[model samples]
Target: MYKDDGFDLVFSYTFPKCDLDGSYQAVQENSTHKICVDKEGSVLTAVDKIENKTLADAMDCNCLRANLIITSVEKPTCEVNGNYSPIQCRRGTCRCVDNNGNQVCKSSVCEVAEIDRDTLKC
Candidate 1:
């Protein structure tokens, strides 16, 4: 069931367990909505809706499959020079540093490479 905040209207429906979760905000008096499907506790993708479209139409129409396909084409940003590379390497007490002063990065640890002649790098 859906309820309108400003109006005293209530909408009821019956369907499978699929649920949409996201945020909506009014920008300059215009409504902007983002809706996503929670697939097994993970958000597969946020389906973008056209202006002034109903929520049911947004999901049932062809947009859902198109959005999923586009998202699937994107690869994880794991390249050394990428923005999130440092945080990804931090799990091993390592940081991505320039290799030969170039943009390429190699793992470099902050502490000494040896501790009592045993490697203590995380």
Candidate 2:
């Protein structure tokens, strides 16, 4: 099953898209949605509701189109308005960010372990 999670298409695994531990993920054709494909890479789980009349050989959907598909990397936080959060965190540091997650506000790199998070205010 899949749903348009605003940002991307999310899925529940069974036997085709994935097995016990994982699911099949691929780059979107136009690189828009962030969803998963079949383990055989034949089927794609759409972000929005789709009608599956019968078992299809191949069909594509664009609900999870995201720029980044590398699941390992951490993404910058964003507001509900789709702008970057004022504060963003890296492995060792946190800093002020602009709408696009660009570092901003002169210098505001606070250590991740810093107690006073106010230092991260932009």
Candidate 3:
């Protein structure tokens, strides 16, 4: 159906079945044209329908962004004042290190700490 409308391609991906109610009803009957909804039931801006590229592009971009977010966030063990806990580095700015064979979150700048230690004077 999409190909006849000049769409480059349509995805056959199936989203985990969500309860259909309220605003979620705005989602179309077609799975390929599914809307990106947040946990709060609001549509995500990155996947919202737009001109030119429109539905397929928005859905593809949303899928890519979702995959990137899922893969980029790493759960590293963090230690604060000798107490250890798992922490997710979703922002990509935080750094965790294994100190004494135990992973610990650095109290200072993560990026600077990632630099090779031998090159630094201190």
Candidate 4:
């Protein structure tokens, strides 16, 4: 379904899920977000969908502004059961030291793998 609701074009959220298509992928992830080129792709802008402290503390605002994208703002949901529990460090703390001595923790409360240094961030 295409509509000229004011923008150049509009694509439905169910756009093709192709990893190789760049521009379309961005637009799919965010219908309002556009793909613009500059002397150096000079902007980075995407609303943060995750609410982890590390990202909030370390994200570079300049980069975020340059590559802006209309990220899906809908917060995620968690499937719970009678025995369901939030992901925790092995010791139940927020963080743990990995074999490499890097602090390991559940990047997201719903995640299962213990990511080290944000590498496993969902």
The lDDT leader among the candidates is 2
Model 3 misplaced regions, further than 4 Å: 1-35, 46-50, 53-122
* Cα error of candidate 3 at position 121, Å: 46
Candidate 4 — number of clashing residue pairs? Answer: 10
User: Mind giving the per-residue lDDT tens digits that candidate 4 earns over 1-122?
Assistant: 23545556634544433335332222112343332222233322333324433433333232222223325542112111111112224432334333222345545533344444244332
So what's the TM-score on candidate 4? Answer: 0.15
- Winning model by TM-score: 2
Worst 10 residues of 3 by lDDT: 79-88
Each model's RMSD to truth, in Å? 15.8, 15.2, 14.3, 15.6
- Which portions of model 4 show Cα errors greater than 4 Å? 1-50, 68-122
Clash number by candidate, in order: 0, 7, 0, 10
Per-residue lDDT tens digits of candidate 3, residues 7-97? 8874675444344553332223243234444434455432323332344342322232233235445433322211122222334333343
**C-alpha lDDT score of every prediction, in listed order:** 0.30, 0.43, 0.35, 0.31
35-95 in candidate 1: lDDT tens per residue? 3332332333333345534532323212322333345553222321111222222222333
Tens-place lDDT per residue, model 2, 1-122, is 23455556434433334445564544223223333444445534433213332212132222222313427567665432223456766675677655445667554353333355566546
Ranking by lDDT: 2, 3, 4, 1
Off by over 4 Å in 1: 1-34, 48-56, 61-122
lDDT for 100 in candidate 2 is 49
Candidate ranking (TM-score, best to worst)? 2, 3, 1, 4
